[model samples]
Target: MKDDRCEGVIKDAWVEQHWGNPINRLVTKVEACYTKLKTWNRTSFGHIRSLLEKKRKLLAQAEALLMTRRNHEQLRTLKGEVYELMVKEDAMWHQRLRVEWLKAGDLNTSYFHSRATQRNRRNFISKLNGEDGQVVEDEQKIGEMMASYFSELFTTAAPSDLDPILQGIERKVTPQMIQELTREYTAKEVEVALKQMKSISAPGPDEGLHALIKQAAAIGTISGVSLCREGPKVTHLFFMDDSLLFCKANSHECNSVLELLEKYERASGQRINQDKTQLFFSSNTNQQVRNSIKGRLGVAVSHQFDKYLRLPSFVDRGKKQSFSYIRERIW
Candidate 1:
């Protein structure tokens, strides 16, 4: 980017053309500039590795010539050329590795190159489990599977009983909160938001799916087991699509919860993976009740639940034991 020849190519390609939308005009200019830059890089720079090697060989010859003859100017020119190529090589590897904190001019090209290669190897998918539960190794099939999976994951489903669901949820947002949220963005606020964002961070979906499920529990559409005599009832705890549901050890409530899940699947186009889902029962609950509920839900039963978000779902009397993972991570 600092090269004069590259700057000339970009400037030449970025010539203005008439377009109605300013954004479209700008995008067109950028696309043209990128096309020209790629051509310029290929024709002029060639492969960085090969070019660097060629420059090193020439530099070695210049040094030998200088040792015998008094050609100081030629020797200095060759040294400068070699140094420039080395800098470019370092930059190329650094960009691929994306080590933002690593300072410029440190010349750790070999380390960056190795890390980049390792990352590419780790990210490469050789095979994947297809929707049909068979292992797929074909590259094209794997690509299609991934594309279809993510397309469904992020796409919003057809509208469900959203209006009734929203109505069921008690209004918690005050007028002041609404006003503040709806107000036009100020320059200082925008600057603060930009500063708070990391280079790799971007906006994602907010948490609201739990509200509908909570409303269902509140209205007794589904009965949730109590944590304690005074504590609030627990219907479900949700983080993104993952959920942990709690209810009394009875077939009726289990069936009700399964019905709700079916409705959710229909509305959201997201099905629960029964293979990954498990039901954990309280110690006091009878084995017969557990078996009946498990049969109704069509999910396996487990004596204990796995950690949610790397933390134990239920914390007992021994706090240190429950949160030992945190201490281990810190250490």
Candidate 2:
């Protein structure tokens, strides 16, 4: 059965004109109602009490309105509108509270107050360390200092061409990825993509990489190899059959870890998964060493990050608070 609240059925035909057109659930009056509801004063107690009364009245009016629209095609829409408004109240409060670890199903003023105080302290930028051994308290000077620091950092001349750095690296895409990419896509794919896309107000970034790398890397036959100063070593870890050959940028002592995947695959039927793999490069490794290892393993690039599984994978001497999140960060 069709979803009653959804809009626009997939047509029995396809055409080039449909390429850029947006799909639905199309915009609704309920969405507009939520928009208006959000503009009401929520900070003051008296105003919020009045707003709650107004919301109650609106809900009552909506219930009455539903009866009148029941005989028409707008009956389902009426139900959807009321449901959205009911849910929107909690969502609106949750947005204002901004407590990442808490949900909005329950509302209390004390919890919100504590969260607000925490946010204020977290965002307070009272003083900044200046370049020339001075404390910068002035907001304008601090802003200028940060701007200059970042500008110099980003615009620093490239050490060398990235292509050369990546030249000897192995192919990141796999056969599984190729198969997925070459397959014909239908309306099902389009619908799934639309549904998975985050809303405009979502916390994540606007764009995400939608590469077929997973499917490509999932070929269970492939494995990785590595060489350490002690000797050759292979360590390819895979949870399922999806083998993402993640090569962590480890000590220059090892040539490649994928070699271990090969060793493991040869010794056993299992292949390492690249999806769970994270490759972090070290600063001390020679360029030739990187080129050799990357060329041998088909790894084109390395991203340096200090976290692995929410734990600090690398140490920072400057800030004690960098690792403090680990104490509280749990699923």
Candidate 3:
């Protein structure tokens, strides 16, 4: 009994640490079992069944880890974590079944089986809420609240000035601004813009472009460049080859960063192509990219907000062409 309890505790710790990551834990367990089997020279069906049972128990234990603590508050916290894990597991198992079916040249069988499994899992989860009427309703309310909060917080705002700028550019350059100029810009233009921006924003010639590129190349090497709830959320600012600034606030930090960039552009003779700028949410790829450029010149890197930038896109060209050819043709 003590041994079982210890096993349970260890399993729970593993699940908690992994945030109930089943597929990865299962793979690791399977690998361990295979290693043991090889050592023992056990190649029987019974051995395989035993290994499978052990893996299943590990997965069950992981699920059980989420099932502990029955209080409303505790359950609410666990519910979110468990739900995310379940979604991830569903995706993973579906992928696995598809791969296996493809390997066996039984695509139809795999598809139906995966679909059925997913349906059953969903049903089982729905049924797990027990007969407590209030619990179910409360949980639903919490879920709705979370969804609404995320929707409000992460929703992208439409650029208020974009239309006017495009119109002005259309009047100046291309006639069919929306249609013709959309595809005109190339990747080369983006590269050039990045280079020019870095050069202008960097503190010195030695540390400007070269240092920024190096930092971008070796992103993970830097400390303090991650998303943390308590850390400064603001990111560094970039302008049209003149100055870089950093800003920090509790929220909407990306806007502050963009504002600084715009201010720098206005101070300098350079103009920002607002239509081309994009805001990248801080993900693994983007964090690396952001870390690489942080402090290259005067750029400050923080986790305050999502990345925002104006880059050259085909839309501006289209707007120009719309003004040039389409409007002219229509007029």
The number of the candidate with the highest lDDT is: 1
lDDT of model number 3 = 0.42
| TM-scores, each model vs. reference | 0.59, 0.35, 0.20
Error of 2 at 246 (Å): 16
Q: Output the better candidate (1/3) by lDDT.
A: 1
Clashes of each: 0, 23, 40
TM-score ranking of the models: 1, 2, 3
TM-score, prediction 2: 0.35
Residues 1-331, model 1: lDDT tens digits: 6467877888788875657698988888989987998898777666877988988898888887876899888888888988888777776676667778756687755667788899889888899997789999999999899999878665655547545445655789999999999999999999799878854556765433466577668767777767789887778776655777877777777776777676665555466678879888877888788777877778886544466666776777898887887888999
| Shift in Å, residue 58, candidate 3 | 44
Model 3 spans with C-alpha error above 4 angstroms: 1-107, 110-112, 115-139, 154-158, 163-331
Residue-level lDDT of model 2, residues 151-209, one tens digit each, is: 75445232333332233345788999999999999999987877776433433321101
Name the best candidate (by TM-score). 1
Judging by lDDT, tell me the better candidate of 2 and 3.
Answer: 2
| Residue 251 miss distance in model 2 (angstroms) | 13
